[model samples]
Target: MAKQDRAVRTRTALIESAAALFDSEGYELASLSTISERAGVSSGALHFHFTSKAALAEAVGQAAVQRLEGITRPQVDDALQALIDVTHALVRALDDDVVLRAGFGLSDSIERVRVAAGLRDKWQGWVEDSLGQADREGALASEGAAQDAATALVAVTAGLETLGRQDEWWLSHAPLTRFWQLILPRLAEPSRLDVLVASGSKGGAPGL
Candidate 1:
């Protein structure tokens, strides 16, 4: 293999191994040696790819964010819908134990504080933008409540994550449906909520 490809593969291996270990053992208890051994690479190679366990944890969190972005980027139709869609998509992606661990662990890591803050800002931005669009499109029912809705949406999703299952990894379709049922009707074109409900997809986008 080319040197670059080989290096990338090794990095992938290290990240995957570290994600699994961190998920199962928690960040403090998971060791570099265990991750390096699981990846079948020398500690030196692991160090070359990621300088420390905290670095590896940050990488895992970043990877989880990337995976979620892939599923959600095209799924949002407007601001509120985008918030709903992306939040749902994110919750769905957490079906994996590694993602669960990374997300759960992100809350407690001082080393990854910047990453956590960036993630929060990203979500908040998306929510605010979507609400702005919904207002432009005349699809917002609560005329002056965009900011409040965005904040509430974030809070609700966080609560859902805390309340939901930690193991077994799949998104609970039933709970998701219930959430939609409750939120969709509050929109401007309240009757057209069926489009989202029937499609079971966001943004009414194909290939999502």
Candidate 2:
């Protein structure tokens, strides 16, 4: 039991160290030796946990995906609010800078390439499912184009991450928040539901 516990600790440390290094330096430049050194574990111990750098990278991606799945998997009661919630959760999930840098930005051709590819597919499917649900609930306007719109949403988020690294200017200029805000209104008819923020005292338009 003690041996197993120690192994688990070592694997966790290695993954964390690898993720941090991958975030600071691109995957191509980061090395297993460096990761092992960072974790204060011998190279042999690192190899026992992850046979190769590719394996370690794959584990990092998996860990990140697991974290995101937990945050974004809630059943959204209000379609409009659901998207908003998803956006908020996604942004928060990226708070760990390494997640944005290594999980999404880096190439995923690790030893477990299939597993990495599955993660990408899972993301696309999740987006499609969420968009489909919103469309049914009259929270989105893509009627005939929900799939395309969902794909575009994914693309934009990925692009924003890459652009965010290059310059802070993109952070404010990017229309991520606005894009969703604009789309949310178009998804359903105006009178079907209140578009503006609800208040105790009525008489104001939807707060834009």
Candidate 2: C-alpha lDDT: 0.64
Give one clash count per candidate, in the order shown.
3, 3
CA lDDT of each prediction against the hidden true structure: 0.66, 0.64
Q: Pick the candidate with the highest lDDT.
A: 1
Candidate 2, run of 10 with poorest lDDT: 199-208
The per-residue C-alpha lDDT of model 1 at residue 110 equals 56
lDDT of 1 by residue, 1-208 (tens): 6999999999888878887887668778889999999999999999898887778877777776665556556455554555556666666655544654464556557556445435555656766777777778777777776766677777766666656545332356566657667766765476556554522554433233
Model 1 stretches astray by more than 4 angstroms = 75-82, 97-104, 165-170, 202-208
Where model 2 places Cα greater than 4 Å from the true spot, the runs are 107-112, 167-175, 192-208
The candidate scoring highest on TM-score is: 1
- Candidate 2 per-residue C-alpha lDDT over 1-208 given as tens digits, one digit per residue, 9 for 90 to 100: 9999999999989988888888778778889999999998999999988888878888888777776676555543655455455544554345444653467644465444445545556667777787787678766544665776777777766666666667644444234556665554555446644652221112111111
